[model samples]
Target: MAYPWKSWDRALFSQVAGRHWPGAEPVLPRLSRAADHGRLWGAVAAGMAVVGGPEARRAALRGAGSLALASLTVNTVGKGAFRRARPLLEAVPVIRRLRRQPVTSSFPSGHSASAAAFATGAALESAGWGALLAPVAASVAFSRVYTGVHYPSDVLVGCALGVGAAFAVRAVLPPAPGVPRPGPAVPVPELPGGRGLHVVVNAASGPPPLLSPPAARIAAALPLAEVSECTEDDDLAEQLEKAASLAAGQRGALGVCGGDGTVRLAAAVALRHGLPLAVFPGGTRNHFAADLGLRGVEDTAAAVLERRGARVDVAGTTALDGGARGAAEPFLNTFSIGSYPDLVRVRERWSRRVGAWPASVLAAVHVLRTCRPVDIEINGRPRSVWLLFAGNCRYSSVGLAPVRRRDLADGRLDVRIVDGGPYARTRLLGAALTGVLTRSPVYEAAEVRRLRVRVPGEGVHLACDGEVAPAPRELLLDKVPDGLVVYRGRR
Candidate 1:
């Protein structure tokens, strides 16, 4: 049962164990133990999530996912397939050995695999983070041999497996593309220290919390900028309108710090007044800001000071009956109806009390239990649907939910519909869970320049950019190409 590589692996393990290095007794063993069961990497991921921007958050999530995949594969398949024995510790230094040794097969090192997977996954999303984590990962891999627990070949194979797992995770959930090229750069005033910039701050926005209040950060970064705070008692749209008017008179840029809803309102006003917009992401899940590559207040401030700007498309809804409520109203992110509007309603109702993530979970459960289909006309064809989603641009998704968009100014609507039928909900959920929702008969996804939707009954509520409003029975959803000009740093 002696393998040809066994002698070489043994000899290498002896060499590593027999060597004496400076400062090796106290640190390496403790580091190895700290990495047991993926604790070290988990702590690193948490730190990145708390302190880093959108890219950092994405890197942390991707790294954690990849680690999980690698660990699962190593334990369930790799180890069982090759039940190699652990290396003999006769030539090992007692001080460097782990207090509690691993009991699994030693053909592939689980710790090494997890480290490689996390580092590779994070690097794939963000090179800067990857560069930082690579050394830690390498150290952990080398520790396996230094502790006299695994052969070098085992560590190498484990790293290879880990890398493969990270790539597999990427294939399932691809990272968003890098900063898009500036779209037809528009001329804008370079405001130093945010002079001539008027910004309205929504004090009630944001989730997961920031290190400091956005207003304070903006004030510190751009001292000369005129900042106004809007509270619950204040009317948001009205305040934005007033700020836009003021900025217009001063020949300055209008700025908004809030969620997608607040940004959407500011955009409408900026477009009306022919003023460029600056967006500071101060909201829960700053989807629009992240897509625009504005990671924080500093990014938008830099863009404004440097006069870096571009034009992006905006989508809106108009009532065929000429109702004021839906007359040429613009939305920056998504518009949806049916069960989804109900979800948004429920989420908003409880978000203030329980927070956004918990509220979403509660709303999802509530919708799944009590929500029903709505009768509507799609392009003059009668249909019953559980949900209808229209995105400003074509979105990427693995299932029924629209995740993110690859292009902002695609000049098209990404429309997805869930047809109502017998066991429609069950079928839809099953398909989504199985990653076959796109192929399911009840699900339909397409991209178009315009969409016409009609409600057969009384007024239906429409949700745009997380804001819910009443809509006329007959409605048209279409894109306004190159509609809003906003500051975005060039890549």
Candidate 2:
């Protein structure tokens, strides 16, 4: 006699066999076959990559990767670990049974694992795509049992493994911008059609290829608003200051069109002038704007005209030593020291020639080869580190370099450090490559309201929102809650 759970599994399988799921007979068998060797998920990933935008491409890549991991695990470890035979098909209807039955162990369904992994991975990247793929994944899983290729328990356990595989993949590279919950709403002047809005567009700012030129888009989106273009020769800070002054004088709002670095400067100017900001994502990798729910000029323009705004935390670094004593700089996104700044510098040098993605790979290689550890005291603890990163708010995911932020006004610093030691770089790289960096001894992360960093000798080169600068030996990093107001509609 089999165990009680095994008996229950057979009973459930028999019940499903007896049920008449209208319109499922033809679909279930064919769907099961379609998912053979993860083919169905591969086709979906290819389609997403071809027709979808950046986010879609990311989803597709992550889905395919997760599917691959799930299939590998199922074949290499899962099947060998349990040699359970395929379910007998005598009770299953002939029409519902697969024409060619699977020959491998049936303790866990490989098809079910692939389906769950792909759906979960894609959804982790983009909920909309995940929602569309979820039903299909479920159907594929159920079809395995309906077609008599796997037991109900087999499919269930396989699905659990698949979802775990998806999360494992996310632990490696992570996903895109998180859901934009733009803090608390704040009152601002309504600038319909850009009226009473002063926008300074960075002429050098370049968005993705799909978008039109930043200047043209800003002009078209905010027609009635005052616009100033900052050329390469023009001092960006001066131009931003001038725009903020104009907007303040007119009791309007200040706007900026640029990347994270440019947005940091604009945020500082806006905060100082007591004015609201309109952020147009007109640069490559607009981290700040994307987190603020402004994906493009149109989004910011609509928010401005509709008088929708929110207040977000602003982080600042105050100099405690050197000539810039007491001087302060504010950053809206991220600040880091050590290998990250080196990586940024190297990437910028080669980005124009090889493109952004390849440039990043090259930068990582270059920095890994040439960069050295820095000695610093983190909150009075002396340590040698390869990197130290602090974000304005707590980022959602964890890894060597986490990207998304769920809350902009959390008023906490998301700090991470990579400890330096013998074979430290190699160990760090291996952990990152294997998707287990979060648990690696070399990596450390924490959330704090403030941090005091002191360098051993001369200050290390630090980067704030991708802009590298020489730092003072001693510095204080703290957040100012609800420090900056920006246009962010609830949409």
Candidate 3:
């Protein structure tokens, strides 16, 4: 499913593009026909009231403001930096716009840019509120077109500018006052933290929150939350060493705001220091975060500073030093072999542009067509398998289709066979469409304390916590049962 594109009817693009190209008569009106934005903006204001707490509300407002500011800045400042011209104003159908002409230069569509910025910023903080605010944002943008003011291309550029501006604003400011934060498990307190948030911002460990307004929202919300930027070049071990130094001397929990990769990095530091680690959903899929009921990470500072967090079990995978000389290592996510590894390789190449899920789909299709199946024994049961997944928690989603069952805290890891015939393929695809995870005929609930899989391949490539490592033919999977101490909500 090449969504948002592949699924999009190609004809629609042809129709839209047709209007912009050729000696097409101007379907949109001239600049003199612009409409009033006040009425539509009032609707946007009404929608903001529906947000959860003071922090959330503030974030929504700030996001919108940032979005608007970005639009204005680009149209006035950034565009001036480039001195670009509007398509039609130059006497030719320059760009596509359903709206009329703007009094100023039109390198960026302020309406489209601000609308996208507001929608993205708001959604990052509260998905529920974000969804409501979206249509209003759309109407604001659509106004530019309906009034014959801006073109489609102008809005596209504006969208980029707006999103950038929101992120830039969020990076400089703290979360809005009175906004409530989400905990992995616990409810937040009324008062903000007096000491500030001891934030561990790992840039390399995961995606950059500074660019992702949603992730930025969560990080900015922490109280008096002092942010410690963790750069990839800097010694992660050293940075955490410093975090532990501070946490060890202070009172309260250790807050980690990043993806699964970041969590593992920070959690490792927190685990060694004997401090309770709090988790924020900053990763792409965030299977673990979703399983625990944490959503809308637009802002998480308040929750962390308040010491309102939950605890969960961490998964471990032992890796040996070449020649099996050392102890095993622990991992938080899934471990797999064969096709999965190859898929990761391909994803590493494309994930930067399309995103994680899209990369995963590309990987899935690649594996389905190429990689040969594998035969292995899991939990002492031998079977011919195409893929063997050992998950610490549930890693299943049905996309747009209905799911079979979802039990995150069943207190067991899941094992499954990833490939099969067309019937099995249909079942798995159906599950993703509906957010309803299901078991495949090739899949089994192999939630055991210890599992042994004798790999048939010469060198078994394994991934634990999305980290690839070496494994011999005989691979053992075991659960520590509340193994590592992590600060999040329910396990």
Candidate 4:
């Protein structure tokens, strides 16, 4: 009972099975057996959890989800749609016959589908880890044909189905930036009539106050809440500190309306006073506020009154020399060294003419053309690095737009280093433009609990949460777990 395509399928299967040399014979069987019933996927997940960072673990989970989908498709639709029988054992060596032959139709190999789906899904999240797993996936798929259980066509079609399933999942739930997922929401005692709320508005920080009018909007939303406004002449840090002190003395929640830098300062003060912090998105990008699901002052006020919120991690840096006085400086977003500060300065200069996003593009071009790598010592090892970025929490380096962390409580820093050597500038620029910076050999990413960096001399410009500061030659960076509680709506 040979089907119309049976001859061609068997010919291909015979070629694959017949070419098995002594070198691969033993290893192929072991690999095939290990991958049985999706065990290989579980192994991959465990390995990633052990060796990979938070993002790697997430990617592995996503891969598992895709594998599940692909398995469902192959077993249900693919098997029933084409009821092809398994390859004849006569053409296969006796030792190569799979001990446990699949009972379902052989038009598609379910094992191959799962393997491809897992690999493709993982690659989409983090290319470095994906590349590491590609060879294993290939071996698993080839084993199906080599074992004489599935025809070559079956394995090929199954692989396609797996890849398709991975893409489908990505479309439905795209990879998130910052924290890939938000932290769990916890209910706080409601603030009756905004009794325990105090807000500070930075008039000079973000866009012109006239367009957004943060103070007026916040007052309208929470009339009972006290608001402090920072004028052009006032020191924003001094004003923020005063507001934080007032809130702390009154045992109230501290709210700050400003850019990421302003929010970061407020967060530090709030942490010191052990008061919950509310963010109003007054910045150009509002990266921190957006990550908290706060769209505007109105949403922030509502969340505060309702007493719904989550605790998030904060990143802090200290001078390695132990010379700088006071507590470690806190940053709510990213901190970078090397050419990044120069790029930011250029972007700011051009932003007035072309706007923020457009200016960034032009600024990158200018910086790449003129910038040179800086020599620094990371963990006592000398290396020339173009840029070193440390994110408060894990961030996705993939995709066109910048990615944030999904879980703020993961308590790990996402550190990325762009290798600086021969043609380093060109390679870095190409990687950034192509959105393959994480995948490029010239770039390296890791999830670390702490990082120590030392420069040869003093007066190094460091960028923290979009604000530049002249820092000393040595620096120590780490995350402060549960550093601040932020208002967030329940999911």
Descending-TM-score candidate ranking: 1, 2, 4, 3
Candidate 4 Cα outliers beyond 4 Å, as residue runs: 1-189, 209-212, 322-326, 399-401, 432-436
**Cα miss at 1, model 3 (Å)?**
34
* Residue 150, model 2, lDDT: 86
Candidate 1: pairs in clash: none
Error of 3 at 52 (Å): 13
**lDDT, candidate 2, 215-243, per-residue tens:** 78877988889888898999999999999
- The candidate scoring highest on TM-score is 1
- lDDT tens string, model 4, 292-375? 877678888888878878888989988866556436899988998888888888988888888888998898889878877888
lDDT of candidate model 2 versus the reference = 0.88
Ten contiguous residues minimizing lDDT sum, candidate 3: 396-405
lDDT for each candidate structure = 0.88, 0.88, 0.55, 0.82
Model 4: residue 397 alpha-carbon error in angstroms:
3.5
Candidate 3, residue 208: how far the Cα is off, in Å: 5.0
Kindly provide the TM-score of model 1 when superposed on the true structure, using C-alpha atoms: 0.82
TM-score of candidate 3 to 2 decimals: 0.53
lDDT, candidate 1, equals 0.88
